[model samples]
Target: MINRFLQNGLQGKYAHYQTDMLFNGLNWEMAGERPEGSHHSVWELLFHMNYWQDFILAELQEENPESPKDPSDSWPGSPFPSSEKEYTEMVTQFLKGLGRATQQASKDSLEESLGGRKRTPADMLMVLINHNSYHAGQVVYARRLIGAWPPPDGDESDE
Candidate 1:
């Protein structure tokens, strides 16, 4: 079930704005940069976000019988996607898989641990959100550094 709290909370707008921020002036190079010592690029960030969304859904299904058990999975390696089309497709597929999981998840199922110390489906979801936000920030900052980022939508500035 779609969490009414999330739908009503800032999370809804936060996720949407983040997506918009990433796509505003994106290009192949901007999406595929590793940038010196950093381990991920914009493309990698997107891939990672989609990947863990699937992972959380998979973990959630260890107890619940209704979740999709698809074997194809999201992606296989670091920076695997080369083109914008492929990168977009991977994220799209990941979101579709997440949609299936969200449809199947129950509040009780989300709270149950899948074993280990204290991992639960809700924990898994939280991890994905946190990770995505981290990488999304990096992507936006990188875009600015690379001179790819466009101006802010409104008059507001970080300063």
Candidate 2:
């Protein structure tokens, strides 16, 4: 039951918009544009989310990945993709990471600790879900600010 709930949260099933829905139909140009007063562009926000997602996944897999010495290291690179292809690749990678996390959540013992760390898989998964959810809202706000909301497929109501 816990695993099921974790998996659902990883997919943003009930708490908010699905990751794929929020990201679909975005072009590089639109992604690169930062709405007024926004701290980051859509591409930047996605990149930031992907950064932590990868980190959490590594820890879940017991990779013992090193924490970035500087907070900014997690948000490295340009605020936007360099081209259409780059943007597409970012989106693909982000979604793939989400899929990986969802798979991890299906494990029988989400409470099992990894690498002698006090944190369990469930702990990491919750962090990932919460982090992604926070940034997901930012992505939506950025899209709306730039007039890119209601992606080509339509809004959550259509779901």
Candidate 3:
């Protein structure tokens, strides 16, 4: 049940869900354009979210992932996507990273401490979920700011 929320679909059985919904219908311009008052664009936010997911997944897999404590490192930019193809590539990678994180989180590690950080592996997963949820809200708000709400092709089932 918990595993379903992490990577499978946005049908969060435990509570709120819907990552894909926020991003479903965005085109290159909609995603890459920064709203008037917002510093970070939607694309940047999605990339940042994927970065943390990949980072945690690497740690869980015992890889020597570079732990970027700097905010800029966590929120780097890409060449402005000149076409939908480039934007699609980033979106695909972001979703893939999330799916990988989901697979990693499915492993049972309730008793294993995360790098002696005291929080167990399970706790770390919860932290990621919370983090993703926080940014997902921002994505929704960004969409609304651009009048991109109710994404034409997005999943609208059950909010």
Candidate 4:
């Protein structure tokens, strides 16, 4: 059975909307052009999430997939997605793919060792979820710092 709390909290329309706002909100800016000394922007975060999901899903299935090569530890570069629509689509696709993987994953499959670390597929899945949420929190903070992020879209009435 799925974890009801996580499914309710993290795998529903609410989660999708929150992810959308973070990646493609009206206040969101381009992935390029950082403010001087800082690194990462809304664009980079989206790109990072998309890239890793592609990587992990392919690896989990033992399929050979070619992901863009980036040397930066932070995976920084001009955003892989050239436009907001593309970014939004990529996020949507990954969420769908993740849901499928979770539903189909057997306990044995989830618990299979990868890289000799005994990482269950569940471990990898949660990493993607947690990692994205972590960056989403950062995006929220960045928006707050600039006073650009408004009350989230679904809660517009509160604004």
Candidate 5:
């Protein structure tokens, strides 16, 4: 059903790559590297993605989270993570948000309005999935540009 599809999309099933797997085998140094011609580094992308994910999740929970007044607020901080620990924390948080969103998908009526807002959980989830997917590709491209693609556990033939 629609919920199943949403869940699959959140997990990157039947898509370019599993959302979680996209970050695998990437080291802190690589995550912080901004290949020439790229505007955002891998770490920045993850951070940005997590920021919006949290925003949508709050809405889903009826927490009434405020969207940043400025668009760039969602993309705050340096383009690169400061250290291995910082990079690891961001990756962990990103995965956790994805998991939370997937769980939310199965528990809601996709068409029901959330917090009296016109948008439903389904709409928010779709936005999150599409947002993540768009950036997932960029992450891969950044990796390839930096000669870090096919993450240690991944195979070039698989893509």
Candidate 6:
């Protein structure tokens, strides 16, 4: 159940814009570039999205995770990455964290409270789905604004 849900929503065919696809072909420079209407760069959005999901996943696993000092601290700071490696590393970490959480779904207690919250693992997953989808949409929009849509070979900036 967990695998299927994640596949379809987080990293699967059901999602029109898969996370991998959304981040694909983007160098650190491209990710840090904000399109006209986007308030946050792609890196910022991805960091924010990943932070929440990882936080909930940690709680679900009974791990001690640090909450952000302020709500905004959860997002990456100003002055995004200057190197492609840093960008790729974050993306890789996010994908791994997501996979770990999904694998634990069937093995872990989905009905138990995590971090004193009344919400269950199922609830956390629901939050992740909604939150990820929303931010993923933003990423897509940013890509479109910069003419990076239809990823990989399509970089409209040069054309």
Task: Give candidate 3 misplaced runs (Cα > 4 Å).
Answer: 1-14, 114-117, 155-159
True lDDT of residue 93, candidate 6: 78
Q: In model 3, which range of ten residues has the least summed lDDT? A: 8-17
List lDDT for all candidates, in order.
Answer: 0.55, 0.86, 0.69, 0.54, 0.87, 0.73
RMSD of each: 6.3, 1.7, 3.1, 5.0, 1.4, 4.2
Task: Report clash pairs, candidate 4.
Answer: 110-121
Per-residue CA lDDT of candidate 5, range 1-159, in tens?
A: 888999999988887777888899999988888899888888889989999999999888898888789999877478778889988998999989999999988974889987688998899999999999999988888888899888888766323
Give the CA lDDT, 0 to 100, for residue 158 in model 5. Answer: 26
Which ranking of candidates, highest lDDT first?
5, 2, 6, 3, 1, 4
| TM-score of model number 3 | 0.79
**lDDT by residue for model 6 (38-147), tens:** 89888898788778988877877778689888998888776376578888888887788767766655554666777687887777777777787788788888877877
TM-score of 2: 0.94
List of clashing residue pairs for candidate 1: none
Q: Which pairs in model 6 have colliding backbones?
A: none
Q: List candidate 1 segments past 4 Å from native.
A: 5-16, 19-21, 36-39, 63-80, 97-109, 113-118, 150-159
Report the lDDT tens digits of candidate 3 across residue range 25-140: 78888888778876677888877887887777677666759888777888756524667887788788777766666666677665578666676666667777778877877777
lDDT of candidate 4 over 1-159, digit per residue (tens): 434433433343345335544544433244343434345665576566666766767766667567556546446456345666766676687567656545535344555676566665666666656766676666555544545455545453211
| Candidate 6 displacement at residue 31 in angstroms | 0.4
User: How do the residues 1-159 of candidate 2 rate in per-residue lDDT, one tens digit apiece?
Assistant: 989998988888878877767888888999988789899999999888988999999888888789989998877477778999988888888989999999999889888888788999999999999999899889988988898887888674422
- Give the TM-scores of the predictions, in the order they appear: 0.60, 0.94, 0.79, 0.61, 0.94, 0.82
Task: Mark the regions of model 6 whose C-alpha exceeds 4 Å error after superposition.
Answer: 1-3, 12-15, 112-117, 153-159
**Model 5 CA RMSD to the hidden true structure, in angstroms:** 1.4
By lDDT, who's the top model here?
5
Q: Cα deviation in Å at residue 43, candidate 3? A: 0.9
